[model samples]
Target: MIPFDLHTHCTLSFDGKSSAEDMVRRAAELGVKHYALTDHVDLGDHADPDFDLEATVSGAKKLLPALREKYADSIDLLYGVELGQFVHAPELAKKLLSENDYDFVIGSTHNIRGYDDFYFLDYKEYDPFRLLGTYFDELLESAETADFDVMGHITYPLRYITGDFGINVDLSQYAPIIDEILRALIKRGRGIEINTSGLRQKFGRIFPDEWIVKRYRELGGLILTIGSDAHCTDDLGKGIDEGIAVAKAAGFDRIAIFKYRKPTFIRI
Candidate 1:
């Protein structure tokens, strides 16, 4: 049984299709006892200038408590936000995080400086190595300063490189850069996530794959969270069993669940 899924998105996110209620119900059905609804929060350059967080935050306030109480007997629910590019908008990011009582936060950089998310861009147009180099650089910068329990999808841009474009990315070229990011998170007592969404995507492989997980373990990085990154009900808890196997093979006997931004390890 998949005990927990720490990263998820519901309709509160701009691109998500499932409701928190539906996601929660599906989790209970799948024997996932602990679940977190971490909708997206992209401030500043990550979002348009006029994009508002108020509506998203307000929706969360009304939905989370109701779902938590309704599922209290069957599931342990936590409210979370996946905040992007905090390094690009520290003041605004901190303000939004401060104004709400989020149980967990995921720091990510979906975009480079002036570009949109790699998902929206045409990967064929850019030099694969240079593009991923920039992507890793931004991730390193975010890791240096974003306030969050874990970094979401440590190798996200790879989705575009290896998945969408069907290009084989030489991860070796960026190992030193990735190590820098892992070390920064370790220094701050933060963690990284095993995002299971990759299984359903064209990549057909886990993000960062098993080797990265092994490297993180070798580096003394202890905190890890597993997630489906599900935007719909059918995908809920998907690949998490493999996620657990990955963690075990990487030397982790347990994974984490966050409450009030603090991690509590759960034995697998």
Candidate 2:
């Protein structure tokens, strides 16, 4: 498998620490064959007050061309976005997708309607089960209607709920809904990303977990991508080898890379 990481963040993201050039350079140095700068473009009322979509999109557009050329010998740098909350503002999402020639767009739901990001929520104060139910419902909606190449971190809420709070979630309860989400993605020719960020965090497993990956494969979902979800330079391509192992274990002979909004599979 080529060392690649399709999901990552840079200074353009509200929570990112490294700059785009820095992250891309680091990926090149690490021998990453394919690297994507998928910074956060989280939208809707639940989005951070400080996030500026126009600036983020324009800044990336300006910075990427030079960086891509500079690292062209070492890396294939892709300009991508982790677009969160597509269901919240469908028209705005459409507008953003139409305007920017994003090489990849990851449809994600950081929070449900009328709530903060799962990272900020006090799990003790809310019903985790209810939140997960809503989260999966929103994921299904994103799968059905969002303009994206892949669904980012399908079990995102668990990163905080179970990883931080040590709460054990009964994933079986959500299986039916998850199947619906997977089916929706497969039907639309969309994909899911196996986010490796959890491996370095309190969570010791990948996002969506192994069973989910296997299930997606079994359900005839062909598109799968792996990512570190790195927010800093040191974390670039982190755990990506392990992510490939997970993909292989899940029975995927090939993984995907996107450019011009079309998937090109790379054999693992």
Candidate 3:
């Protein structure tokens, strides 16, 4: 059984379909002992300019207790938010994180230079090597600025670039940059996730790539988490077993789960 799924979305996020109740029920069915509802909190250029950050945190706090009680005996639920890096909104990101008591926070670079480049950017024009290098740089900057508990989807852009485009972006070529990012994350006490969502997408490879995972372990980065990044009920726990195998292959003997902001390690 999967130890915990720290990255998932319910109705709390913009694109999610399941409610917390449904998610809890599904997790119970899968024998998942711990889970986190990490909804997206976009800090990009186009997010509702007047969005109430305080209210968002308040709402999440208010809902956690009820959800926890409802699923008390079955599974543990963690309150989390996925914060995207806008680069320009560093202060806003810091403020939101400072004011909230999230059990876990995922720092993601969904935007570059205030633009939503995660999905909108075309991968064909530039050299794949250069593009990936730039992406890792941005990720490093985001991690340094936000100082979050975990780095979300370390190789996110690959989800859209590899298969149909037939671009052979070898992750090993960027090992030095990858090492820097992993080292920075380790220095900041941040964990990297095995985001299994890529398995269901065109990328066909897990985040951070296998080589990055191996290097991370070698660099003394032991804090690891597994997640589905599921937007719907059916996607929950998808490829989690494969994720565990990947982590074990990378030399991790345990995976982490969080509760009330405290990490509990589970043997793989």
Candidate 4:
């Protein structure tokens, strides 16, 4: 098992099944030395009504510190959030980040402008390639400006487009955009994550694939993080060992853990 998980969800997230306390307790039981409860905080046009940004961040802020103290002896629980669609609402995103105290933040773009999350979209109605182009462009914008510790699930669309719908996507078509996104992240000293949730889901692979991970390193990007992106206690840390192996293959000897929005590297 990996020693830490940087992205995870609890009851604070709309789709989460387990409570924060239960999730933390279970992480300790499984010998996870470092962990984070990175519940979703979606923003702007695509955000649903159920995900109250203030409530989610405040709840995590109020609850996690106490849990961190309670489990101080057994686990190093970090307070974190997955801040989605930061490009859509720059002022709101800046305000939220400035006001809150978060140990880690996963920057993501769940959908393009005026569209639902890829998971909820009807694939038959739209051109997947066009949608992917928009997604990467939006992500590049987010990478250029969003304040985040790491970019979450860079290949998120493939989870549905290829994994669920069985549409074989030639990502090489978007290589230029992908390179720009990676360059933006590297220029700003931000990193990308190897999200392992895809391994268990229909995708059957880590997000962004090994090529992107290696390319990130090749382009002078030094920071990388691994996460299960687990939404429940049972799924926490799942496929994390495989995530580590991928990181190693990508030429990363150390992975990052965030505290106070700054990165600290630890050997894998």
Candidate 5:
């Protein structure tokens, strides 16, 4: 059984609906042994213009100790943040990492040079293929530049590929690029995540595709984490069992957990 959910969002996140205490209570109820609260931090001002970056970091620091004390015995709660990559905001990204001691840091490519097809509301002219290719390139660059503990959803742009966008991801076309990204992550000692939230979306699969996971293993990338990316209590632990099955099928014998920014591998 997969006992840890390393990527999630609580009230600290702008889109998060559940409080930290609520998430802890739900995790305990579901018999989850470990988890992390990885809230979204958009580097590009395009996603959420009203988000106060400094205040978000400050709030996260303030809540960590109490939550840690509250759930210390029953469940292990980790402090983390999900940073969106813009490449231009590398300095801000580094400053956040330097100032705090986070248990985990998730680097995600939410935009390609200030235009995010996924979260942007007025994305009418978005080209899926070009956006995907650009997103992958930016992700690889961010992995090299950003000092994050883990790379957030590897193939995040897939969520917006369907519906009105009329984009279909064949995976075979982007396999080599994804392999290069995974290889870069491995070289930098960063980990990849099995974002279960993707299953709830139209793609009906986790990030990076199953083939990416297999290639990651083939390239000696062992560090992996599973996340529901839940905004509410009910979404907690959703589709994680299937995620574990995917990981096992991809030849991963363990899942990585973080504590005070250090990784500890637990056998699945």
Candidate 6:
């Protein structure tokens, strides 16, 4: 069973449509013991400079307490954020993370160095290999310096590169750099998440794939979290059972959860 969903987006995200209350209620119906409401905050050149995190944080602090009390009996609602591209805005990232005591923080690179979001880019206009190389480069920068609890959807852009662009890029060429990213996270005592959104998407696979998870395990990286990256009610809890299976196949015995900014292991 998929016990908890560690990565989810609610109304706080520009693209998300569901409210936190709705997400938690849906989790209860789905028997998800724990659920995280991880909205987006992209500070890199890709994100709008006008993005207001203070307002979002304030709104969350206001509603979360009541939600927690209401769902106390049925679900564990995790208040979290998906902070993207912190390498481009380290100061702002630190300020937001320092000021807000989040239960979970997911660091991701949704925007490349030149493109703000992978979704907005025209994959046909660029070489897939070079573009993906730059993608990994930026992701490494985020993993190397950002203060986040888990790395969300490591191979996110490939959903587009492989599916939309119909280009097959070999991951072996980037294995060395990928290992560096995993080691960096390992050294910091951080974690990597098994994001299952791609399974429902055209990618038909989880973010980071199986080899990446196994590689992290080989590097002695233990903390693994699972999430659906759901943006709507219907997508909630999607692909999570498969995610746990992937974790087990990668040789993980448990999944990690964050509470009060610390890691807690839960048997999968």
For candidate 1, what is the lDDT?
A: 0.86
Comparing 1 and 5 by TM-score, which wins? 1
Which residue pairs in model 6 clash with each other?
46-116
Which parts of model 5 have CA positions greater than 4 angstroms off?
121-124, 163-166
State model 5's lDDT: 0.80
The prediction achieving the highest lDDT against the true structure is 4
lDDT by residue (78-122, candidate 2, tens digit) is 889999999999998899889888889898899999999999999
Worst 10 residues of 1 by lDDT: 43-52
Per-model TM against the reference = 0.96, 0.98, 0.91, 0.98, 0.94, 0.96
Q: How much lDDT does each candidate structure score?
A: 0.86, 0.90, 0.78, 0.91, 0.80, 0.86
On residues 1-268, what C-alpha lDDT tens digit does candidate 4 reach at each position?
Answer: 3599989999999999999999999999988878999999998887887778778888988999999999999999999999999988889888989988889999988888999999898789999989998999899988998889899999999999999999999888888889999999999999999999999988899997999999899999998988899999899999889989999999999999999888999998
> Which scores better on lDDT, 3 or 5?
5
**Candidate 2, residue 19: CA error in Å?**
0.9
Ranking by lDDT: 4, 2, 1, 6, 5, 3
TM-score of 1: 0.96
Hey, what RMSD does candidate 6 come out at?
1.4
lDDT of 3 by residue, 1-268 (tens): 6678889987766677988678878988888788888887877675645455555566777786678788888888788887777355887877777777888888877656644455665666655566677778888786566657778888887776675566667777777777888898888777888899988888787886877777889999988888999998899889889999999999999998766556679998
Candidate 6, 1-268: lDDT as tens digits: 3589999988877778899889889988999888888888888666866567667777776777678888999888888889888888899899989888788999988887767688777877867788789888887887788899988899988888886777777899999999999999999888899999889888888998899999999999999999999998889999888999999999999989888778888897
Candidate 2 lDDT: 0.90
TM-score of model number 4: 0.98
On the 0 to 100 scale, the lDDT of residue 43 in model 6 is 81
